[model samples]
Target: MGGSKKLIVCGGLFLTLILSIGATAPKGIRLGKASYRKVTISWQAPDAMTQVAHYKIYRDGTELGSTASLNYTDETVQPGTKYTYKILAVIVGGGNSEFSSELPVRTLKSASFENNQLVEKVVDSFHDTPKSDLNAVSLISAIKAGFEALLGSNISFSVIDENIVTSVVVEELNWINTVTPELTETERLAVQSEIDAMMDSSFAGNSFDHMYINQKLTQLGDEHWGAGNRTAAELFYEFSLNYLSNHESTVSCSLARLAYFAKSHLTQDSSCADISESLSKAKACSERFFDFFPNSAPTSTYAKSALSQPAAWYFSYFPKMLEYSNYDALFFSTAYETAKRLVAFDPADKNAVQRLKRVAAWELVTLQLRFVDEKGNARTGSVKICNVSAENGKRDLFHGDAYVDEREFTLSNGTATVPVYAGHDYSISLNVDVANGNKLKFELPLFKYEKNKLVSYDYLTNSFTETPSSQSRTDFVISSTAYPYNLRADRGIDVFDLSWDWVAPPSFTTAGFKVFRGNMEVATVNKQTVRLPLNNSANEYRYKVVAVDANGNLSSTSQILTVYPGDQSQYSDFFEWMNRYFGDSDIYAGDDPDNDGVDNYHEFLNGTDPTKVPGPTPYAGPRGFYELTLEWDAVSNVEGATYQISRNGTVVGTSSTTKFTDVNLVPGVSYIYKVKQLTPAAAATDWGLPNTFTTQKAHNYEHADKVQ
Candidate 1:
């Protein structure tokens, strides 16, 4: 028995030695490419080993280090130096494996110099030379070019280098520091003469070059003006005037200031006539400046001030159109209108407004009347009308009869009766003497017996055709008593109809108008006049107008105007009707009816009803106390849908229901659920339809409930 036990122990020891040797032996090894900076050495241990102890790393013939991992890296090496590495697997049994295959490594060098040269060449190609070198020019030389380039390039450069270049130039000039010492009379006069010469030369021709030079001169004038060197400043300012005389610009304020200064400096005994003339010219130039540069702040403000000067100055310049036979009334009218424009341009100017009112009052009446001789011949005279009375009993006094020559005059032939207040008598008296040919001449009594009645007389034939009565006249005639009676005659509404006139009849002078339908007034416009509003609603309309005078005198209503409005519904009906006439493609069709994801027709073949909702809920789960997750196949017929989950017919949660989950319910509570699919049409329409699903009751383990 002892000998058998000894043999078994010896065999077991031999088998243990063989297994330990087999476990430590290396099975397979790998060597990566040497080009990479770091190399990885890996080896697999024999299958006979249960666990690996560590891996030994060998660099060339030396052992670098050892780790428990199966792979190792050899990091210590010089650039361009090749080194060989291998890994050895060590087992827990106190035996080691042989080295694996070798890995050769060498470090990478820096990039080539040719790439650096290419980058330098690209940068050099993009760099630009200095502008001065490219153009071969100085600043002043560049400015002499045309305004297009002057304002575009030169001003751009100045704006960019504004702080640096302007400061340098100003420092060199020392302009502010040179204003201390008093100059002798002779020296002052010399400087003033030079300034005047420069200004005169700059304004010799009308050009943009002259304009730029004038601007520079104005700056110099401002400097001299600030230093109290009035004479020099005056010279520069006079140059500005010359520039403006033919070439208007946004810089006329300088000229106006010079004129004002010159006017202010004159003694009281100085010729008012000459001062008036100069002021007139200055005002005109300022006005032109405002018109040319309406958006300029300085010019507009200066123009407003310039226009406020006394009216005598402007009146002195009024053209003597009536005095000279060669001049027409139209010419004087245009001049008056120009002055009115100035008044309108600056409505805040009190002086301008008052002057305009005075001038317009005289001009409006003078233009309205025509003077004639006793034989019914047109005569030229300034015979003005004064103390004219209207039907409302208001009287206005006017400056009259400034005739250039003496002439016997009477009212024009066929003059109609002048309208006046009913039941009132007017006394007409001439201010001329017949005895001395200048004494108070003739007096007559004129009466208006009733309202809306005509008192007609012919002065040329000395005949009384019709006297005022209760009756009204259907045939209209020009009344000598009214201003602009003949003015509206030429402005009939149409060639075929001589009824309505563009210029309002003197009967409707002051108040706005009202349009009435039969006896009812439809619209009342409270302005001086009314323009008919256009209608395009496929309807016809007729309109009539009546005027209310300033004194509350109502005129007879005007004739009617007939017009038709335009149409749109036919275009709107075209789209709807097209589908019936031309079929499906003629009109667009939207998604199918049925809330199912698939179209109605498609669901028919898929064994699913499109109108029916998807599969049952709680179909395969317990009644309660069970975590649940739900998912459904994406529906095609619906854009989006909402889902609800319920327990025992009570809703627990709701979702847009693409997915849902339920958790933590009572052990014996039965639950049921339903899902509905909703489909929506195009954004312009309402939702299409909905489909629904119902689930059976489910219970927890304690209750045996059927799951649907």
Candidate 2:
């Protein structure tokens, strides 16, 4: 029996040794590329006696997940955060290895780069061009080439080649001086003076230097133009365009100026390009500028001059027109209604036809207006186009005539289309009558549209704005009030899965919802639920939801909800500051739970319990017949604290020593005083307690006056 037991023990020890040898930890664990939202960690496969099945990843001392590959990407990461990661390899059989050495990784800090919507809009607008035409292709290539030169180049924001830039500037100056037709003596001196001034200014080898160079060239061009020196003006303007090539609006402005020069002067000189070429270049740049910055196109100084010339010049070149005066009216019509006529008018010149169509589509947008009642039910109403003011210094579209300027439309259904000229602001009123003979009028002011679409209104910001997921829903009468109801939040270890039901009206059909963290949009989804990652460093977070319909109209945002994630034990500071004082009560920063006249924020700043209201303890009495004295215990555990004494609710005086005296008081009269402690240079706390006191009456009067 002893021999059999020894054999069994020896066999068990051998099996354990084998298992230990088969399980091996991952080796050479290192970080791959890390971005703002994700971190990639890779490791060399471990050498195990059995085939490896998978690898396990642990982040910040917890198991994140298992991956079958050697590299794993942890997407649940925040920007500018540090995390510890470790890896372990598991054999195909069953045994797992010990954790690998912990590796510290940090995600790249985030900044405001080019937003996704701008990129999409730029690309989409570019694709709208005639790809087959050589001129169109070259124009598109120029845009792509511009981006490549800026982004693909080795230029660094932190560094610049000053010597090279100085050399280029000197070469440009020399070229300007050696023009074939030398400037007049006065012109020469003036140009030299401007050049000297430009040389005197500092170039800081940064983006500001680029701006300075471009602006100086433009200024020189303007001066020459003002002096009627066309040659010098052309020279400076061309150089300015080259300097501002990467700047969309400024470059477009330069191109537009050159185009105008070509048209006005009909200059076909060796240096001045032909009218068609100049206008074509201007059209391309202006379209790009408007596409990327639709909001700023109306107000931008560059856009005003850049976008105003293309459509008119292109239309003027057409063969046969109804009349020169009717061109504006024809271009303002809807693209769908005018496509056949426009195409037939210039079928041979496809490029011309396309250009006119593009400009017309961009210039005049068909704004869709939806009128609804308080419950989102469609309401029939008349929209009177009361006023229209052009931003680019043009005459108003409407005149005093009701059919011309003061146009009104009846909404047969709840929706109607209005012609909104681009670069113009409008004031329109919607008049709707309710069931009880009551009429409602909504006057919308400073409203504009772009590319036949109205901008989405952000209730959170209470303004017009755009995001990648937020589409233009057109203009609407009923303010979105269908807030998401019965919202529920399920907190995971590092995420919150939020689910809510829409108290949607019958007329509302939800297309998607935008999720926000505070004022920042976190995510957008088509469903009523979203799973959002929580910042491990922060215990509390605020979130809200806004629903969007198929037409892009947004519902009123849900009430801001505050949530605390993870177990309470994780945040020791929260416990020490909040739980220790309030004892398991859920307290918000803005709430005054104790009705102490001080909000929790001030209570926290004052280092007082939010749940307790300090009661007044009368401690003042009369010192003499007409004088009163006040004293109180000083507040403890606070540094540089002072006291404010109030007499009858007015600040009588401030005391640092906790003792104050009131003199010149009427005898037998009571005076109320309130005392509150204040921290240095901070908001004052609530009054602790009110103390009332009366001065001693003059009981023993002098037995006799002067006569007695």
Tell me the whole-model lDDT of each prediction, alpha carbons only: 0.40, 0.54
Best by lDDT: 2
**Per-model TM values vs. the true structure:** 0.23, 0.25
Candidate 1 residue 255 Cα shift, in angstroms, is 2.7
- Alpha carbon deviation, residue 350, candidate 1 (Å): 5.3
Q: lDDT tens string, model 2, 616-684?
A: 343864366567788887645467777778888788787776678877777679888887776554434
Residue-pair clashes per candidate: 13, 2
> How does candidate 1 fare on TM-score?
0.23
